[model samples]
Target: MFTTFRGGSSGAWRVISMSPVTGETLPAVPSLSVTHAAAIALPLLPSSNAWRLAGVASHVRYVERNEKVALVAVQAGLGRPEASHAALIPIRKNAAWWDLTQNERRRIFEDKSRHIADSLKYLPAIARQLYHCRDLGEPFDFLTWFEFAPEHAAAFEELVAQLRGTEEWSYVEREADLRLVRERV
Candidate 1:
């Protein structure tokens, strides 16, 4: 399925904060909307009005059979009632990262960075979904969406910090941290 994230003046999610973690940044939007469809068209945002990002929900990459099994066993689904807090992080890797073969990149991502292993600890607490956009000519390579309850916010921060400190993050050329909260009726 294709998921599209739209940031604008109104949405089901209220944007709380947006800060650049590395290179470029996006204009601040008050809210966000997430949509899913089998076929979707990219919309052109009028400069200061809004922004949209889309990515496909594909098979997990850079993971071994064992790791995949482990994730499936513990990972929680998104949009849980209590998972009101969310983050949308857009990341772009340097050309050097893309030049490496899949195995080589996997080694850095898992063997060196322990991305999957470390993340397992925070499992059901912080549910996450990853979207790939490199092939779509998008400015960012990956868009990761994470959701958690208010009480788990600290844990979420710790998780992000740990991932960023890893060697794998060295390949990231641009990243933005966008935090949001589900709109209450």
Candidate 2:
């Protein structure tokens, strides 16, 4: 399956395509445009494969750690000014993620809350530092954290260009609500 999430102030849409084998969703590829085709029809084509390779490359270069609160931090680069950082906090009972009984989901949510509270005394600090680092536009802006990596930013931009060239892109929409906080210390 394929799922596309599109959102912005002007407008937004999402398209989902499904895979027969696993019944899983994958990112949808969009249709290419004429102008884009004219730009890349020449010698610049070969280098495109590099991105595919990069995608398969080991994420080991990235340091990953999970906290009891179901938050995962992926820190890459070593003291480099351009270092990339991303933190994923999976709140239990993500309504958009899956379908489950309310009671069961509530239990999971409570468990996650408890785990988060019990994991570390400094968790509040960590959360504050990360979430409050910058103001991205909306709650869904959290997704932009993954794009902060220089490499990822470039690659994704290229990927979007390529997809636009093929005329395979579609649109979909969703609502995401989140809170932001900063650490005082």
Candidate 3:
């Protein structure tokens, strides 16, 4: 009864998740502090509705791509509550979004959209990672994972609200928000 996303690039990426509906099993499902999953029909990840759950792990920043997100922007939750609460948000851009020039999209994402500036306020409190799933050919373009303590839950919600209300969000044709509460080992 567990789910596992492909982490650690050893050349092969694995897609392992318990099939809740079918009752399939993954014997090697590791002991996870937090996990999020969506048993949805792939190919078409409709925005109006997407089964979502909470999860963990982060690697890089969306803006700087390979560069790491500023230490001030995310708190690893070391020696604290990294598993207290978590969120996995999947977002897919519309066709028109891809049509835009790189510079144009960057302008909207940074300036008019204010996606970065808005999120800066809630940093460290809400640990997050922006996963670009587009290249992987996953349904969503980005899988943004977030973790925070229960005390900062409200702040996390506010941060999401701010980003969702921005102009860049308009390109998000499909979205799935997975909320998760970690179970103690």
Report lDDT per candidate.
0.92, 0.24, 0.55
Inter-residue clash pairs, candidate 1: none
Q: Candidates sorted by lDDT, descending order?
A: 1, 3, 2
TM-score (all chains, Cα) for each model: 0.96, 0.21, 0.62
Candidate 3: list runs displaced more than 4 Å: 1-83
Give lDDT tens digits, candidate 1, residues 91-153.
999999999999999999999999999999999999999999999888899999999999999
Expressed as tens digits, the lDDT of each residue in 123-174 for candidate 3 is: 6777766655575546666667677788998898788788878888888777
Error of 3 at 100 (Å): 1.3
Global CA lDDT computed for model 3: 0.55
Model 2 agreement with the true structure over 1-185: per-residue lDDT tens digits: 11112211111111122122111222222211111121112222432211110011112211124432233342232223332322221111123423555554444433433323332332222222112111222222112112123344444334323422331111112312211111111
Query: Against the true structure, what is every candidate's RMSD?
Result: 1.6, 17.8, 10.4
